[model samples]
Target: MVESILGYSPVLRHCFRNVSGKQFPRFQVIKAQAMELAKEPGLCKEKERYRDSLVGLKPGSWPPKNRADNPSLYNPLARQERMGCGWLGAIFEWEGVLKEDHPDLEKQSWLALAEEEGRSPPPGFVVKRIACMKNEQAISEVLCWSRDSSQLKRMALRKEDIHQALQGGVYRFRDGSREFVNVLTRHKIPVALVSTRPRKNLEEAIGAIGIEGVFSVVVTGDDVYRGKPDPEMFVYAAQLLQFIPERCIVFGNSNLTIEAAHDAKMKCVAVASKHPVYELTAADLVVRRLDELSVVDLKNLADIELTEFGSTPELEMDVEEEEDDRRPPSSAAIGDGFW
Candidate 1:
């Protein structure tokens, strides 16, 4: 069914057949497609407006009071400002490493795959199961569908293309990434780079951006058994920096990273550089640009108590229910021989 819908080859489908039963149960193929659809600009804006309306309503008020009477009732920006005060450490994802790099690489890659498969790609998502796979796995899957073995042989013969793509790719520092790093450094805050890219590629990109020494610690895809939405990478990074997860704040451009941070008991600030703001509602706060956030906001985030504001009941309930449905059965429920 998935292959027919997504135009995935039998070999590619086989690779993901057991993914849902793995450690990362959230990495299901169908869910990735659903997520892609939910991120459509129109749907995203509608959801945001709904959330904003809820935020404007009086807390715990039934039947919801009139907005005209409760004009001073809610301040969403103030809530975000308070949440920002509690951030002690920051974890940056590598999407922020290069500002002007191939913004549509995923789209292009998927289009290339579609061409190889001799079918039109599905709409609403850049890639099918490719987004859920690790960097190495995604590459292998693409190679498997190529027209001939020479494609692999050619890749072996010209390894420099890989290096050149990594080192000489069209990329630059994001609008205020350099300034943000400088501010963090001056304040003596610990900053770590947690990226899904391989260590060598990450190093080359960092070097290309000329921010080599900015990060105190770097965690790459090669260093982790599981990737984003697993919490392992972010947790490991926190441990390496000698800070508890709660003391760390993650800056990410994807829902996966935000979910991972929340799972690790860390606060996340969604950077809407690549994704829309509504798509990042799982994050503690969302900002249009990195420069929009300041040192004051960071300091404020570190001090605020999240429980005081209370959760967005409707959204939180939905997220919790979804997580519960995805959670694997407990070991005790399966008995001693389950493993």
Candidate 2:
């Protein structure tokens, strides 16, 4: 009876029979099926409402104001086009690097640095601190623990050991990132991996994820004098890919990366896997999962002319501020200019 109702294999049926509560299992399965069936009407109504809302809007002006916050606004049927150049930011948390290693040590290091400076760490420091740590400036400014004592060297050694261990371990791809990359490859879009991790560690993580050759270009923290919240990495990536900054679409999960993309005058899609949707408001578009973003969306974004959104005071301010903060350090202190 179970096999006929649910089409379970004989092996599954045998296992179900071995269970003492057969009736409860059968009832639960039937209830779940019934509930799913009952949801169809509501689902259809929601979809119809979404479609109706798009009726009079301009083409490609989807995600109506009412549905802006709804992640289900992803239109699978939306048109797809061949994108010129694509820049993919490595989803660090999804790669299992954060899970396998402790970010706490790095956080502690930053806090210690803050203590030495006799100042409280700024709010949202960790968001940029982790990325900054990859740059030599961070080591010189925030992590000058060596000057204090040998204890700092031991801490640094322990951190190095953790990173080494991460290189040997495997990294799990985010739920839909692999499929998303496959789609981009199939469309022949040139995608580059821009990351805040050091090149060696970034390469190792990419290799562990089994996508070593997926990206045409890989830019790491070691490649740039500055890190996130700075457009240097993204601009350098655009240069390496031979893409105009405005034509490239950046997909990132952090506020700093999104800001970097905007500063570079590139369209950015914020993946809210790491941060909340509200926090990612700076992005051109926000989605709860990578799976929600499709090739169609990329094409639409790529075709958008920057002039459509006239320059705003806030945007101008952001760009100006970035430029102000990006002054070239002395050659003796930090080498050449950023990028």
Candidate 3:
């Protein structure tokens, strides 16, 4: 039944909004109200009418029942299937690297590259995979451990081969990313990409698309002292924007990224660009595509609306490009040099 609904509209995936009521799960206030109304039919026509008032509830969608729904194949639970088998998988599947030559790519992509080379990964890539709980718990744990001096020390002291493995070329972006970045920039919300991808590929991709200037900041794996599910990247991004962490909103397609934003106290909006819905439960809101979001719509997002920017640019584009050491910017350069 859930699959049938998902087939029709996969974007309206799952709910994560906190609801209140002694009786209903958080965010199901209207259902609780409807039950009361059911006992007083004279006051309301039906439970459906009362249920419509709840926040984040779709108008006509029925809530899933745990007993009736299969949890194993649930969208969120099954999202692991969509992670594309990590960087190595993407390299082999695409028959090529995802990036162009870049000077500042993070050292991490070397792991993916070495795997592609069929050579033994450096000892750093062989770092022990710590036992992790499910997404939500892992997020909290990553944050807690990142703050430890011991963990940081261990990460910094990787074998020399591992450090050598971190170097690599970067990804080249297609025109689609440029258009998307343009849309984001025109909305007057300074755009920034918070990615777990190594900085090298991100730099290459942004340069290829020609829109690197659109984003005021790019928080890559190297930018943060720790990666997701640690909040370091999110917090670093917030700091770069000079915005309060709570005032920032993040869009991520992964559980780790969503958890990072949550841990940082930033508003998190998850997109189903890759993972399924259930995997994104940690986010405050979920959408199937980021193109659905508009600057005007963002203004209405109370949890993440733009209250102010110190000197944010208004919606306008000036066409131009500039030279740089890394990958070329992805979108049309902002002519005003606002960046």
Best by TM-score: 1
How does candidate 1 fare on TM-score?
0.54
Better of 1 and 3 by lDDT: 1
The C-alpha RMSD in Å for every predicted model, in order, reads 26.3, 26.9, 25.2
Candidate 2 per-residue lDDT over residues 178-273, each given as its tens digit: 677777778777887776565666777777767768787888766887777778888998888766666677877778777788898888887776
Please say which candidate is ahead in TM-score: 1 or 3. 1
lDDT assessment of candidate 3: 0.44
- Model 1: residues >4 Å from true position, as ranges? 1-87, 96-98, 110-129, 137-167, 304-339
- The clash numbers for all candidates, in the given order, read 11, 0, 20
- Please give the lDDT score at residue 184 for candidate 1: 85
Runs of candidate 3 exceeding 4 Å displacement = 1-178, 196-201, 302-339
The Cα RMSD in angstroms, rounded to one decimal, for candidate 3 relative to the true structure is 25.2
Better of 2 and 3 by TM-score: 2
What lDDT would each prediction earn against the true structure? Answer: 0.63, 0.58, 0.44
